[model samples]
Target: MYRESLKKSLYDKEAVIDVHTHVGMSPRFFRQYGYPYALSVEDLVIRMDMLGIDYAVTFPFVDSAFYVNNTGSSKIETTTEYCNFPFELENRNMLNEVNEIFPEHAHKILPFLMFDPSRETEKQADFMEEISEKYPVFGIKTASTYIQAFVNDVEGKGRPILEFARRKNLPIIFHSSVHPEDPWASATDIVDLAERNPDVRICIAHSARFLEPVLQKADGLKNCFVDFSAFIIHCKLAVQNSPGIAIEDFRFRADYSDPLSVMVKLAQTYPDTMLWGSDTPFNYWIQKYYTGDGKLVEDRLECGYREETEILHALPEALKAKVAYKNNLRFLFGQDI
Candidate 1:
């Protein structure tokens, strides 16, 4: 059924935009976790074509080859002296590569400039402004946790970039987390930021790590959106860790073994604010799961582009249309395509 639906959508030339994806290299992931380091425009386009994705909003890998120590650790070490601008190289490379190498398919690839607020905030914003004029920069992407900054720090470290986005009318996608220790980019902080800057469109990446706080208040803020990239993995982890715990006013039990149930319920509840994203390359890796026999099992999460497409295809026609593409158009372009 999903394949049939996908084929029809493809034949109809219906737009299927993935709102969250990464490109470029991540030495940290490669060195520490043995994940694939390089993801180029060609690589992404091949996967996007295979998945029948019409367009994808992509940005450079947040963890560029700058940091020395693990970012997840208490102490972060960086080769700051040698590389003052964090994502400058990667962003430039992405824009140039798309424009020069993939000129014919450049329209299919929408690149967002990655921002690092902790280092030369004003300079980085200046660079972004310059690039927006030169290239088709769709929006801005920032991970507060990577930079050890606060998303709601409007008057302090976060102000310059926030101000830039507002002035340029650019949407910002933040890498939010549900981890207790990583509160810098929590859904609460992102919501606060969205409330404060009502004009700037803000997307809480990864569905605020699938927490309930953002889902509870998403509809109230017109400029705020959420993407469920890597949601199945997070949901599985949450269920495994806290099977019976309620997700803070979510009005649903987290005890379900199937993560798709939670995803469907949330999407049905907040269809307007939902957007589809794959978090590709990373999603291709193997994942561990506990089987019914209580034995730990290692396998892929079985929720990649094809699986996600199936889930979306299973939705009611109206809701499926919105989550699969319409919401992305509204969020990124301020209109439906």
Candidate 2:
């Protein structure tokens, strides 16, 4: 009885199941800052524990070569010759490390296998299938910057990978940052895929940002949903555009051009279709500025996660429960949660 009560309390209306996280590194670009890999799953867990987040679907930031080893060297290096060193956050080995580190929490964490679909073809599909069969993985992750980060590339190399996911009954989460530089997993690209592969469950990271076309797509497509990772669920931040005319400008307030107000409105509008994600570490932007020559320690919990939890707590209990854990649980486990 106590266990049941505890489960009920933890899975309360405010309970959050973060759908996007990196247990190893930020996407490649952020790695240049000389910060140690924030993808440390242990560190992520501590942060999640502080924030009351029960589970997270982790995707390694991927570029084409994250999964390969040198021809002769038995030691696996985390980089590729085609791309620069340090590779993207989507390293497959990092997924292995995370699973190894938390065997018990492994099921709660869904690690995405990273692949450069254009380059890795059959080998990629084979590895993904093997891992899915051997371990508990949520799905696969692909980056849009692959084409943008390289030259002479057309469209995402993710189609073949998605095909493998379809065969395996897995979901693929794509990062659809509102920012324009993010090219590979744009809302249009993902929408096209979702339309084509109706069985594949696609979670668009960052609530499809200013991608109205993508947001509208979620309304009709049952398999599509948005992840609120970078958006401000807590405080108001400067928006790129006031009127939100363009997709990039839509960052602050594309829905109604009101950043602060849109979160609740959107949540109410699309309750079951939304998933809460801290998108932590990257979310440290909330504390980017400090008023001292010395370090000031703060809670460091992503404010967006906190705010979203509060907002979710305010919802009708049933709806809050549905969005907080049941929604993803249903999508992931059918009826377990």
Candidate 3:
């Protein structure tokens, strides 16, 4: 529906900004799960134009080396040699791709430096600082789970990065999860980080995997924002796994079965804190699995850009404007769109 509407110029192209998107390759995902390894600048820009989006906040993919040790796999030995400092090469490549290849459209592609928490904080900060000086680094992007670190390990891993962001006045967007087993980037930890450092702006990715606590905390924290990338898929998972949780948590009367309506309600309630994101290429590809007989089966869970755009279009005009782009402008630059 959005695809057709966008083609008809029903939406404002200049009013949409995707806050969560990735470029470059992830060797582990490609090898292990048969996911697409590459998303070039041209590829993303074409998709953005088709969906009537004007800008995108992007970073490189989490390197394969970070997952090899945790996944008990030795297939990426060659990749591991270069990926010791995760996202180092990928970030550089992204900077070069946007700045060199697509210089005309560089301003439209807001690039964030990927911060690796497992490495020495000072070293990582030093590299980020050096790169910022060379390129247009808008903000910082990091995933604690990808690096096998906890988001609230402030003293050990998170504090130095927060300090760096504060010093530079850069917003940090984290990859989060609500799954109990993977507590690395839970909403509780993310909220703790936000509470401790009120000066630094922080965005909880994927709406903290659509958890209730994130929405509650974000409503109160001025510096805390939430991006609903992959909202359709994650919200459904949230509702199916825990029925009536949305109604119980937010005290709303909407049916949890319909994630889109719930999303509109959430955005209306927290207009200032909600931001839009598509997660892009990731939302397009489905994970492949192996059967007992060694046959590869594709699980086509297809709630992607089309569905995400539809959700944005479904919102009331005033709320849609904020979630689509205005909120991200404030979150990233402390300004209006």
lDDT tens digits by residue: candidate 1, 248-314: 4553455446656766777787878988887876565453322223343343444555676566556
Cα lDDT of all candidates, in order?
Answer: 0.70, 0.54, 0.71
Residue-level lDDT of model 3, residues 3-96, one tens digit each, is 2333223233446889999988876567666565678998989888888788889988755443443244222222346654656677788999
lDDT minimum window of 10 residues, candidate 3: 2-11
Error of 3 at 199 (Å): 0.5
Better of 2 and 3 by TM-score: 3
Clash pairs, candidate 1, are none
Question: Count of backbone clashes for each model?
Answer: 0, 9, 0
TM-score of each: 0.84, 0.70, 0.84
Indicate the residue-level lDDT of 76 in model 3: 24
Candidate 2: clashing pairs of residues: 23-39, 24-39, 60-89, 60-90, 61-89, 61-90, 62-90, 144-184, 144-185
State the TM-score for model 3.
0.84
| Residue 29 in model 2: lDDT | 33
Q: In candidate 3, residue 194 scores what lDDT?
A: 81
